[model samples]
Target: MSTCKNCQNQLTPDSDYCNKCGARVIRNRLTFGNLFTHFSEEFLNYDNKLLQTFIALFAKPEAVIRSYISGTRKKYVNVISYFAIAITIAGIQLFILQRFFPEAMSMDSISTEATKEFNLKILEFIQDYQSIAMMLNVPIYALVSKLVFIGEKKFKYNYTEHLVIYMYLLAQLSAIGTVIIVTAAAFDLSLGTTSLILSPIQFIYIGYALKRIFNLDWTNFIMRTLIFICALIAFTVIASIVTGVLMYFNGDFQKMIEAQKAANEAARTVKDTIN
Candidate 1:
């Protein structure tokens, strides 16, 4: 008999892993080659759970989601792990943009100096705390989904289940967006332009996934997608209002106006010099 190092379970002499804890029976001492091999098997292998989950979600989101919801968890990566990976990737994307392509994220086209500063600050804040922002959006997305799909009886899903759906959808979208952005950056593409192009694509994919999950027909899918868009717009407006109020309290609003006037005068002086 052999004792498992991880859980002290007794195993047959030739067992490759512990039957109780599933830890590999590492008879050999730890070495760099074995460590690299372990890393490859965990992450880079085509049979790895993460890679399998990523492909399956794109190919058949409905099946993966439904299976997970129905208590079939082992086949795919869980929702929390998937979302965590998305956040990590998103953070890396932001870091790359800030570090390598600072000009791409710069708001140079805006006319007012104060407004530009304010906008840049907002952008910086989002980039700095993007993980929190992404996590916060997940629940809001779940709420929006619940509102849109409240009438379904056959696929009656509660609030938490809706969270699972959006977590998967949003994580998948984030992964896709990161790949697209990174590729675009390699070609010296404008980050803002790339992001704008991705907005509609993200919406379409979200709708497609939902359609698959609910088995919705063309008419229902279109109607629901429109409603989802409207809900998002409404949420955006409300959030803007709240943010504006906070800025006003902090005296940023008044400063912005004064700065805009100064910027305008400066622009006029430059134009006069050229003329």
Candidate 2:
């Protein structure tokens, strides 16, 4: 037994605080090393949690997100915070690649001018609305997942609960996508090849995530995964239709296509003049 340093109350030697007065008892002297030690301990768990977050997020996302939604969130990052951080990371990846690797993004890497133009349009759309597009997909994804898994006998996660899963999934994808882009840039990989490599990684991540989350048998897992993917495709089609309608009514879609055509024609004319 020992005495409290602040209140002189009796306490155990290992006690961190005085029980009587509730004063801290294990304080260390303030110095550069101690300051950094304390700062790092609080900084990592309370605020700067991306590293520990990705550890669970990539390795066992279902478990982590489930724990979070279940209200035990001391160890896992908040879902919305993770999603926002992931978006920022993806944006940074685009910024770095655009600023540093111009040749990798040039039309020379693609097979044809038409393909290049298509990719350019897609990229432009993504750059303009990727964040909003991704956010909107979350609820649509949750709805699809719920409908697909509505027949599960063992466990049935509710619609709201599925949002937790989808949010974590998107966060993981954004983080992994950022890494993929950075790697592709480093290796001078073309966008087509990058997508080819990334698609499988994305599928595998979600596959294992579902596997762990639902504890499904192989047959059910395969069935659910396929349906989930199809649901995502359906959601994409619906979103595209909605986007097209909005653009059409506002004259943006036609203007965008016309602008693209004009640019392509101008490039051809310049090439012909040079030749």
Candidate 3:
């Protein structure tokens, strides 16, 4: 027999709650069975439901959200869980693709002296401020959504709702990006005309998806689309500038390599003539 500390009620050894006051009772012994029971209670008890929700998320995102928001949440994946799984999958895909496809990992592949320098500098910057890239998507989406929805009454969504949209958008983009990366890796293809042309179209899809998800009207939807396009342009400009700065340094390196090659060729020519 045990007693509750708060209510002073008599409790059985196996009892978790006080009969009198309903306060929780703590067990003194921490055995393997008790640990397993606690673990089971927290995470493992809902394994089947979690798996079911995950499947629904990939199959029908809108339906999953609709179900969850309408109080049918038990049968679907929670928004946080969906976001976590999507982000984890995206991260893993990026890692694998980058490892296997060096060209795909690069922003540009012209391989000019300037481009080489820029690439090295960008790599160094990524290594130094890795966390910045991880946090960029949320803030970028938030800004775009806020700007697009400004002064609009019917199209307005709260921050949390916007966050859900952002997650969905991220998941879609990550899936597309993964497919592109994997294909490039398998075929050893360059980021040529196909990528350049399709990339803008992908943003169009994102804008359309956002409009549908938020139930925005055509005017508001167009504004959101423009915001996305602007954001893309801004990102491109920043990347180009960074690459240019790095290329300046790379030019010196390229000169040394060129000079070494020329010297070796001249030496070989002299030896051949003497022989």
Q: Which 10-residue window in model 2 sums to the lowest lDDT?
A: 106-115
Give the local distance difference test score of model 3: 0.63
Q: What is the TM-score (0 to 1) of candidate 2? A: 0.72
lDDT of each: 0.87, 0.78, 0.63
TM-score of each: 0.92, 0.72, 0.55
User: Relative to the unseen true structure, what is the C-alpha lDDT of residue 153 in candidate 2, on a scale of 0 to 100?
Assistant: 69
TM-score of 3: 0.55
The positional error of residue 228 in candidate 1, measured at the CA in angstroms, is 0.5
Candidate 3 residue-wise lDDT, 1-275, digit = tens: 77899988888878888889988787658899888987777457756655555455455556655555556777755666655665666566656656776565554554454355445555556545534554466556766666666666754566666666666556556556657756776776654423564577667666666666567779867766777678757866886777556655779456646666776799899999999
User: Any idea how many clashes model 2 has?
Assistant: 0
Which residue ranges in model 1 land beyond 4 Å of their true spot? Answer: 107-115
Q: Compared with the true structure, what per-residue lDDT tens digits does model 1 show for residues 109-138?
A: 442464575776677778778888888888
Please list all clashing residue pairs in model 1, or write none if there are none. Answer: none
Candidate 2 lDDT over residue span 63-169, tens digit each: 68778878988777788888887788777877887788755554345436444544565667776887886787689878988998899766678898889898889
